[model samples]
Target: MHSPTLASIPPEVLTDNILLRLPLRDLIAISACDKYLAILCNSDALWQRKLRLDYDFTVPRDRPLENVSLKTVYQRIGSPRLFVWKCEHITHPVPSHRDFCELKVDRRVVSLVATHSAFYALDDEGKLYAWGEKVHWRRLLTYKFPFGSEVLPVHIKLPTPIRAISCGSIWITAIDTFSHVWFIPDWKQAYRIVNPMLEQLSSEAQVAQVESGWRFIAILTRSGELHVVQPRSGIPNPGQNLELNGSIIWNTPLRLATMPPLPNLPAINVGEEEALSPKLVKIAASEATIIGLTDQGHVLQLSIPVAVGESILFEALECGKIQWEYLPFLSEVEKVRTDPMYSPPETEFEKMDPWTQHVTRFSRVFGRCPPPPYGFLQMPPRIVPTPPCILKISEIFISDNDICAYSTGPSSTILIGSTGMRASDRAEVFPAHQNRPVAHFARTEHTAAFLTPQGKIMGWERTARGKYADEPSMMTIPDSTKGWLFLSITAAGCHFSGLAIEWEELDADTTNAYESASEDEGDD
Candidate 1:
């Protein structure tokens, strides 16, 4: 029976082994063991001192914002990929850790509007989130003739555990704590917001079915078509009806008669064969392009030309430009370069091979690398490819867990940053891994900037290979990109917030910092 106190421990012990680390739970337990340990652990700055032993706060805090993890402003999403693009000059760079904000959903976000795009999620203490934005279209919610024909809206209870929501263009869909399926029309209960041009939906259009594992919800009809719907409300509305609450935003019938399975294909999965009705899906976006990843490592870039039928294998998706159709699948990274449409001007070979996205897609391409083809061309000049007519992104970038693209614009440019510097470079719409040129960024053609915590701006030159770039000079930006920022994350998992310096002089800053570090070295 003893009452221990902080006075017992020697002062020298506190400073000894400053870098030693103890398990967090064990430290808490040790503090609770007796009164003496408790006081010492609770000292003015003891916890921070102990924290420093195991963690490097300086490194973490000083990490550039642009270099943080592949997170996003909307942390509620899972696997957030940062994207930055300019129309005048293409300068999209693959974001490291600093780009993304952490998004952790209590559950997964899986909302499939059509084959082109499905929804993923992220979360920050349930305070923020961002879902997929599909093409926007309106379904007629209410169409009653003013004279006499009454258009009664079908009634449904408001959803619960839902927050904010949106729908895809060809198919209006939404997501919440639990995602839903709806054929959205422009009718309103005053409280429920619908797309203004909403078309009337069919009865079996927008019902949400709780998917297995509670990972996501499915938007399908009583028949075999799929679409996405809005999510449920996080806050519950006790006893509200349609007029008092909202009309059921549901879907219009999508009659798609695809081919049946071809003879060469293996027998259908045992599980799929047993299902009452096969869960078949096809996605279509209004104008925005979407890529679909199947469980088998298959990738399909979506367009709106329907294939013959369900009989076509997953790899056979090739057709025209429609709002909704199969996203043409790519067998090799090289295949991503071929023009899916017949337009010759639109064709460029796939040079920037995106890494495997095992988290989202089930594709055969994973772990498989293809040799260079016979006609494969070497790296070309950093000329920005002709922008797509619809302003859709022709290229996508994937670095580690992050992906980005130069999807649109009247311009083209990309910006990349390092701790001591930032660089703005032109993005060759078609950059291959081997032939990719760092010289492309030297022109500042599109003018991108990298920001830092110390209010520093680092300009960059696209170099073939070198620790320091020798050309194009540096840029300085005084104003931050404001609230929104481009984050950079390092391979070591360090994060750095980036601000665009309105004006940056590389010769001045780099020379100073370099000289200072050199002097310090000489002092030793």
Candidate 2:
């Protein structure tokens, strides 16, 4: 008897047992075999198994499995997503594309963050991986660490799974599932827990979020408290002048004493200052600034004052003396209104000086002395405009000197200080796509990417003169990859990187065989 072909096998058996065991790449190839086989290959059960095996995706119990499509689940959970770095080594190496040959990592990455010389990734299993310059890699590895070279990625497994990760110019911060925070300073040999206070606080109340600045780390606890930490090299003494090595050594987590109270929240205790005691819902940090969002949706900003010619390294050691300032635009407006310089000119001649009254009467008769032609009276002092008010911010991303904030309601993006333009004038600088909301936004030292609601990637880069070229252009994948669904995109230094999933289509021979097999099975 002739051997039964794949098309002649029962669809239920092939789908339930045989096809589910094949790899994702083979399943893609098999989907082209025919109409009926294509349907079986694309079934929910098959894709669900593929997702669990390939990507370690676990469907949430709260979701209704019957109503959700397998394709949707795959895109949302199974697809690989990562942050790509566009550094000099990755974008423009001396030998041209040589870095691509060295850019090989064995694990599947879920998220990544990179600086100028180093790149770090968190795998699906929450393991940390590092690869970059030899000096940087050696700094992160312990004396007994196995890796001897930085050319290959090295895996570092922590005691617990990492929940969040952030990178600064030369530092890294990660939070574990148990809410413990770890810090890695520039040129450090190993990561360390933030402090005993943070450890105790984390155990009591989980750390909801963590952010890194150029020289500082901001931690927000679930109890609504905000704490800031800075790395110091030597023991912190009262009056000793210490030199810094540009490496951070977090000593203790300090509760910021200047956090403003949220609107409609209960007043703080009798001795506790309102500014020091509001529960923060979210927090974000830039080079020297921190922005906090209260549960009541109030936006609060605090920044470290940098003196002229002061280095960030020195400031890192002096974090204890830094004071947080509240950014109240309304109060600033009131102060400006009360200033004597902004007061309207006096109309009553009785209050004017004798010389001013004489000059005014002469001007009233002689067509107003053409205002002093020169000197002090030539022009009034220029009035400084109020800072732009940013309300209802959904998310914010900061890189180098650029700050990008996404607002709700209209779903518009706000770019600040990226192009050296005033914040008020920058409202129209970023490109606008009608009705398409941005799902993700990221930036490097020079370029930025925006992922839209329709799964399209839009990107823009700074020109040689350091100005944003008109608007963003559509980003496309490589020609070699066909029928791939683009998931996320990021830009760094000079190159663009993205994550995508492959999709397959049915072919003619498979379609004919599937039809013939169906007809024959019906006759039997």
Candidate 3:
């Protein structure tokens, strides 16, 4: 009899004991040598394990969609690109593409958030990884974690997996899979909030979302209630010395309280009747304000009345003085139906107020160029009727003075406004993105990025010490991408994070094998 060969081994034993132990790169190399091995290597069970191990992703209870396979999902999230500006003061060449903190995460980054000097990423396994100034400064100056220099990302320790995470200027807030809230005052360890109200709230209702702004955190419950929490350690205390940085000397414990209902509610018109009140479904925050979205599409703005460099007073919060204000917006109908024409006024000073006339005269004398023959005649403002166009706001994003409102649809209508913009105030509509719809967008203190449907990223940024770019420009994908297509983009501080999948066009044979694996397996 011929000597027994490796091919005589049972396929199950070969896959489980031998092939599963090989690294992904090595496995793919070996699979190309034999057609039989290739079929076995592309098995659903094999790729499923690869997805879980390499990307920390698990398929939902729902079956895979037709023509798509687990292997495709695994390949799509494998490419994670990061670009950072080593010299934030320079603007010549774009920020160079580099490994995240010079170390590869390997796992897929599902959520990423940034503070001014730090970036926090949450992998699919709920593991929190942090890198940037916080990690480097602590290790070098304070010798906090001597080994952290090589580690790059300091994997935070927690009791349970974090389902979601948000970062403020100094604090990182997280909601665990169990619906418990955790605060990471420092980057290394996480401590769960032990307030009686929070404990009771968790048991009564699930946490729908958590958002962090500056040093304050807001928790939204599924029941539509909102709770604000300010950690004493991170917030500036007014009672302390005024000259200090304000956040370092606080000694009071964490202050947690419920937000008062909106004092000024906007009515949403139904078919024939108008609903006076609607429940808040989402929220976004900046340093001094919180923007809330109602289920009926009305936008509410709440100004957290805290002095510059001072913390919120808990007593005033309970008193209900801080309330949500109704924010009016231009509706799509008004944008299309009405046209505001700007023409030379009847007279040079027709619509010009006293202050405007003074400014125009001042500009002519001290201006770089001579003023127009008519000087600057202000355009007459058009008055929108009572009950201003209340837009159906589907979502909102806030970063400092910039606020972005997105309407419902795959191709959303985006309106860019500021924190305190009024109904009559004109909002910016991006002319560059008019033809290409945006799929994702994120903003840090100085940077804004938008991702298109076709794996393209475009944005503008103000360097830490440089001026903001006048127009958005397309970002160059790193050569390392090879055949990967970016699917998501996010920014924190001066750096950006992107997640990509392998393009199907890169390997037609592999793509076909993935889709026909079931049929091939049955034939064997």
Give the best candidate by lDDT. 3
- The residue pairs found clashing in candidate 3 are 76-501
The residue-by-residue lDDT of candidate 3 on 135-210, one tens digit each, is 4323332322121134367677776778778776556778887787876677644556656667777676478888
Sort by lDDT, top down from the best: 3, 2, 1
By summed lDDT, which 10 consecutive residues of candidate 2 come out lowest? 328-337
lDDT of 3 at 368: 46
Q: Whole-model lDDT, candidate 1?
A: 0.28
208 Cα displacement, candidate 1 (Å): 9.9
- Superposed by TM-score, candidate 2 places the C-alpha of residue 361 at a distance from the truth, in angstroms, of 42
Count of residue pairs whose backbone atoms collide, per candidate? 132, 4, 1
Best by the TM-score measure: 3
Better of 2 and 3 by lDDT: 3
Candidate 1, residues 127-244, lDDT tens digits: the string is 2223222222332222111211221222212443333233332333343333332322222221323332222222323332212101112233333343322222221232433342
Candidate 1, RMSD to the unseen true structure: 20.3
